[model samples]
Target: MIAALYWSMNIPGQVAMREGLEAQVKIINEQAQQTNARGIKLIPRIAGDGAEGIEKQIQQMYEMVALRPDAIVIQPTDNAALAKPLRAANRAKIPVIAYDQYIDDGELAAYISSDNFQAGVMGGEYVAAHFDNQKPIRLILVEYPHVSSTVERVNGFLDALSGNQQKYQILKTYEAVEPISGQRAGERILADFPQKDSVDVVFTVNDGGGLNVVEALAKAGRNEIFVATIDGDPKSVENIRKNRLTRIDSAQFCGPLGAEAIKAAYNVLRDQPTPRYALIPTFPITRETLSLYPGWAGPIPQDFKKPWSSLEPMWRGQSRVVIP
Candidate 1:
């Protein structure tokens, strides 16, 4: 019987991560069905957006690792804080695959994720080029913590703005990951940094948070500012199409990468060769290509149909999708 442990942060709040996890779970289960192996059992977990919440989640992961499953797949709540669990898994000789978040501890079997730094650079450069030499550029920054991608994206954005900071000063940075909460945070920040007829741009690390900022700006009748974000979920892509958001980088293939990580784990177990890291490209999504996505591409709640334990046989090549 083959088993796996998969951890994902609170899906109810972060749509992009939630959707990515759900899609991977779906593919993993389907693959298991074909393999006729004991299904890939996933131990589900989530961490919210605060220090206390993250601490609790890390403790839970440590406890779960004691069960000693075949592999542990995770989008860690905090890569730095979760080192203890990875170390434990390493001692137990258990293979671990981290998705979306990279663990530099060198204990994991492999890491899979999008190139968020490049996405951020593109976003920053796009905005900088668009608003060249602008005056009184009031900027609002919406940020989230814990996730490595979030931190990297912000870093890349700032890096691109190097030597071009005077024309665009950040007025305020808001916090919150959930769209509604993010919107409220944006509103509060807006009230404090109200355009003053000089605000020119708004930036968010992820699309869900960006949407909240856009909603707050719309309600306040502040449409003159350029908004940019990472993750081209349907809504954000739509915003770009409608001209509400200035740019969108769709690091949208995370789900597929997660699914592949499981396959990589299986290959490792079977003594087959596989890459230590899988890099998924993040391309910009504009109004011209927004229609290509499914209607549920945005911040929709995850509704996974099956559990990981029931999907084992599919991975052995039975009940699998046949490619042309």
Candidate 2:
């Protein structure tokens, strides 16, 4: 059997995404070596991200389908763009395992991803804790609209804040999941909110350009603006420890997430039972809880008493969403 692994836009900004893809590829090779049989052969594809990314990703998907690999595992870039080709793959009777994000339309043998929404909620919870709820918070959001995981994380973060009845006004919204845009966003934040306390909080959807934004704030001596971000890049964690503008960061279990996809695909090929969807949990690394987390290459630490995780059943009733 042969399978193709497709990672949507594996670019420099997304450290965890690249790491996850690498981990997935590594697991596949290891499995093949262990069996020493005619095991599944792998082909890897990455959409060179830029203005032409969607087009490139679409073309890559169609090409993968044409190869007629035994199965395909893809991390979808755009929710709706991949539908047609995915349906084509379905018609060709190829099983697909989607990781990180799901397509708007497709039949997948299995889908696995981090509990992105929960990660966002953790960020929101952190913000909620800092404020007394008497005053409105001025929030700056850094986002990436193309990917489902980023969208879900933003939604989850907002939901947690609103659900907690915390008052906040969105001061500005910027788009950056990579360095250039991220750096531009940082410069813009400084320019727009030159006055201290002009921006109370900055919530970055991921660590891609997020660390850059944090650095920009720190360099400009803008320590008053509280920062919260997702993706447990080691740099982000170190910043938190050093008492930078960033107060909290949610870390994705990237390695485990990728490994799960391969494991699911392996099961699908054998005609075994596979869950329709899997939500691997994400860990929030804050100063108070940083010791518990071991970074991305992790034995994702157990929960400590936090506002969100402390609720009955943990992670507010989604605790069962852990690595299988």
Candidate 3:
């Protein structure tokens, strides 16, 4: 069997996930060779950056469909933009597995990603714990509105904070999909707010932006604001350990996500039933728990338990909506 693994950008997180996928593919191939069974041929490609990158990803999807790979695993650059090509792959009878980002409209064999909503909830809970309901919190939110995962994270965070709505007020929201965009947005926020007293907390959807926000705060000599975010990048973890501006990070099990994506694609190719959606769980890593964190490129702490782990048996036979 053949598979095409399409990645969005060459960011740190994506790179780590790709490494995990590659490792799993190697193991699978080795086992197949030893057993004299068919092995999956994996073709990997990465998009450029920004708008141009998204276009390239769309083009690559169309090309992958033309190649007629047995299956295609994609981490979409833009959630909606790649729908047409994804549907084309479906029409071609090729199973498409979406990783990290969900395709809003498409016939996907499986959609694998971390429980983004829960990740946001973890961040929100961490922030909420820092202040009592009586204390007012001025919050600045930085988010990437393009991807469904980030959207879920934002919604989850807000949902967690809903109980304390009266205690916290969202001052503004900035759109930042990556580090550079995040830096720009952070600089703007700093320029506008200027004073440390203006903002009490900052919540970023991912560390890519969260780190930049911290930098912006530092540049303006305002590190007093507590920051919480998702994606426990190694730097973010270290920052949290050192008592830096970023206080908490909800870490995604990226390695497991990548391996699961490959496994789900293989199952579909083998004519086996695969879950429409498989959500990996995330854990919060704070300064106190920093030593235990396995870092961004993780082996995932064996002792760490996920709420959905016990429900997998039930999920296996659940009915799924097949996109036409």
Candidate 4:
């Protein structure tokens, strides 16, 4: 049997990201079965929310290394600490594959992630399109550190506005501990923003953050500011459906990514050399394209109904843990 370890930076429990990773795990297992290859088994490890100091995460990485699974597919907590585990895996002859997040290491093979930079550009373009022209636009950006995906996204967004800085002025940048903290930060930002309608746009790194910004703006009795974000979570999909705001998602394809990583590990097991990276291109998702896009929306099965439960904050403006 080909054994692999999977770790996500989304803490021990958060239904949305957890469900996505679980779905990815399921798909990888099924793909392994269909191929008649020794199925890849995933051993899951949690790394908190990437905010509660790095010591625990570092310890977890070492534990995962000690177990020495056939391979490890990881979304790193701290990009720097990732190198130690990955190097240990390498020394032990276990392949490492990364998805959604990248760690700086030369020996590791393969990364399957959406083009985060392009997604950011799409967000900027969406906001620009709303204005019909690039005018003096004031905006707020909420982001986090160590998640290369998020950083790449911000780079892409800024690149999209190259030579267009005059058109968009970033009023402030707030760093959140996690996506849930983003909501609280959004609420605080609302109070600080000028009462005048000067702020025209809000760009967040993910749907969780964007939705928080939306909630805060709504609470402040403010609308009309174009909100854009990454991550095609169900709430973002519902917002698109209702035309609440425009979103440029990276079409979070967790299954395909995990499956590809598993396939690569199988190749490694077979003593075959594989490529160093798998660049999954970004797929833009707007309201008109939601139906064609599958698996990006949350709350899983379409047969279920909860009357806005899909869009309602699963985190409920506060962060907590719910393990499965």
Candidate 5:
């Protein structure tokens, strides 16, 4: 049996990521009942949310190493903290496949994740194009710095904005990735900027808590605020369609990512030459591009020969798989 270690399931994007992993197990279990082929069993472990959760995850990684599973698939919490266990796994000749997040130390058989940085660039491009004439665009960022994925996204967004020469000043930054903290951010934004047009844009790292911020602002009638967020949560995309505060949401191809991780592990076990790293493209859902997006559970839409923007946030007609 192989072991699968997942980060906090409380986050929507992580939940979507896990769906792909679970789907693999479901298919294998069903196939085992009908055929004579031996079934692959997966041992799943979950971490709690918050600071203590980080400790739990680290401890779990150490324990997983001791179990000596054939392979270990994980969405790591703190990259440096988990290195010891990962290195131990390496010594044991146990292959490790990571998704959603990556660890700096230890050898991973494969790493699969969304193009997080590109997703940020997509958000920045939309902001630059949407407010072309709006100079010195006042911005507020909602970010969580603990994870590499979110940090890469913010860096990509800033880089794109800089490339466009769109002059903008960051007004304030807030931290939150779930409901309670997001509500606090929403309330703080209201308090920080009471007047309309005081703030031009807010970019949230994901929809997990980002949605709550939208609701808080919407309820308070803060219609002028344009929000850009990552993660393809159905609610976030719907908000764009309804013309709400959320303007653009760059969504991850979560199901395929999860399935890919399992496939990568399988390939390693079979001694097949597997790519060390892979990234699934993200679909940026704006009001104009919403029609092209299939919900998280649906199939990935075919590439659009003519995309909505010249920047081209997604792969379009190319393979959904990208190695970068």
Candidate 6:
């Protein structure tokens, strides 16, 4: 058996997560070798950056399908853009698994990803609790609108804040797709609101952008602004521990997510029943609880308490397998 794993981009944090996925694939192959079962070949390709990168991704998918790999797993660069090529794979009778980011419209054997919406909800809940009875929250949201996962996170964050409109006033929104873009966005925000206490809180979809925001604020000596973000990147985790700026980061259990994705692919290839969608868990890590966090590329903290415990029952019901 053979499978092609197509990654959207080769960013630092994503690279760390990809390593975990690759490790699991190796383990699966090793087990097959020992048991004399059919071993799987894992092929990897990374889409570079921006529009050109998306085009490359589409072309790669078309090429992979032509090669007739048994299965293909992809983290699409864009939600809707990759539909055509993915549909082509469907027509080829090749199983396609959507990993990390989802294809908004396509025939997918399985969809594996973190509970991104819940991650944002965790961020929002943390922010609300921090400012429970305090003055109105002057919030600025930095988001990447291109990807479905980030969009869902932003929507979930907004949903959590909807109940307290009076308490949390949305000041503005900026699109920061990556770290450099986020830095530029941060500079713009600082230029617009020159005062030290201009914005009370900032919510960035990912830690890459959030770190840039932190840098921009720190450079301007605006340590007063509170930040909430997703992606428990090592740098972000360190910042959370050292600097008082970052409040909470909803960590995705990427290692478990990758292992589950491979398992789903294996099941699909074997003509076994697999859930259409599998959502890996996410938990919030704060400065106070940093000691318990097991890092972003995670073996989930055994003793750590899940921030979204109430939603666990529903999550367990939806997920095909329970993750530790």
Preferred candidate (TM-score higher): 5 or 6: 5
Clashing pairs in 3: none
What tens-digit string does per-residue lDDT give for candidate 6 at 1-324? 455555544455566557666777888889989999776778777876678778889898898899999999777888888999888998999889877888877689888888888888878767776675346789999998888889989988877666434277889999876677778888988988898888989999987677788888888888899999898877778778887588888877766777777777887887788888878777677876677777766666554444432333222213434222
The 10-residue segment with the lowest total lDDT in model 6: 309-318
Quick one: how many clashes does candidate 2 have? 1
Q: Rate the local accuracy (lDDT) of all candidates.
A: 0.62, 0.78, 0.78, 0.61, 0.83, 0.77
| RMSD of each candidate relative to the true structure | 9.7, 2.9, 4.7, 9.0, 2.2, 3.2
Give the per-residue lDDT of model 5 (tens digit) for 1-324: 778898878877778778887897678667767886556688889986767777898888788888988899999887677788889999988999998888878898889888899889889888888786447889999998887788998998888788877888999999988777888999998999988889999999989879988998999898999899999888888899999999889888888778888878877776877778877777878888777888775577886642544455445523334543
TM-score of each: 0.77, 0.90, 0.90, 0.78, 0.92, 0.90
Judged by TM-score relative to the true structure, which candidate is superior, 4 or 5?
A: 5
In model 1, the runs with Cα more than 4 Å from the true position are: 1-39, 104-106, 134-136, 163-167, 245-249, 288-324
Cα RMSD, model 5: 2.2
Against the correct fold, how does model 6 do in TM-score? 0.90
Q: What lDDT tens digits, residue by residue, belong to model 1 across residues 1-324? A: 123333424332244444655566667678768987544556665555557656876776676667777777766767788887788778888788777776656486777666676667656666665665545456777777667888888887777666345366777777755566577877786777675455677778876566777777777777777777877665666667777745554444545555566666666776777767665555545453454434333332232321111111111101111111
Better of 1 and 4 by TM-score: 4
**On residues 1-324, what C-alpha lDDT tens digit does candidate 4 reach at each position?**
333334444422133444555565576668768998655566766655544545565666677777877777666666776787678777887677776677776366666566677667666655555563446678788787667888988887766665233377789888753557777877777778848586777777876566767777766766666777777766766777776744445455444455555555566666776655655444456764566566642222222221111121121111111111
Minimum summed lDDT over a 10-residue window in model 3 is located at 309-318
Candidate 3 on 84-105: residue-level lDDT in tens?
9988998999889988998878
Provide the global lDDT of candidate 4 against the true structure: 0.61
Among all windows of 10 consecutive residues in model 4, the one with the lowest summed lDDT is 315-324
Candidate 5 lands at a TM-score of 0.92
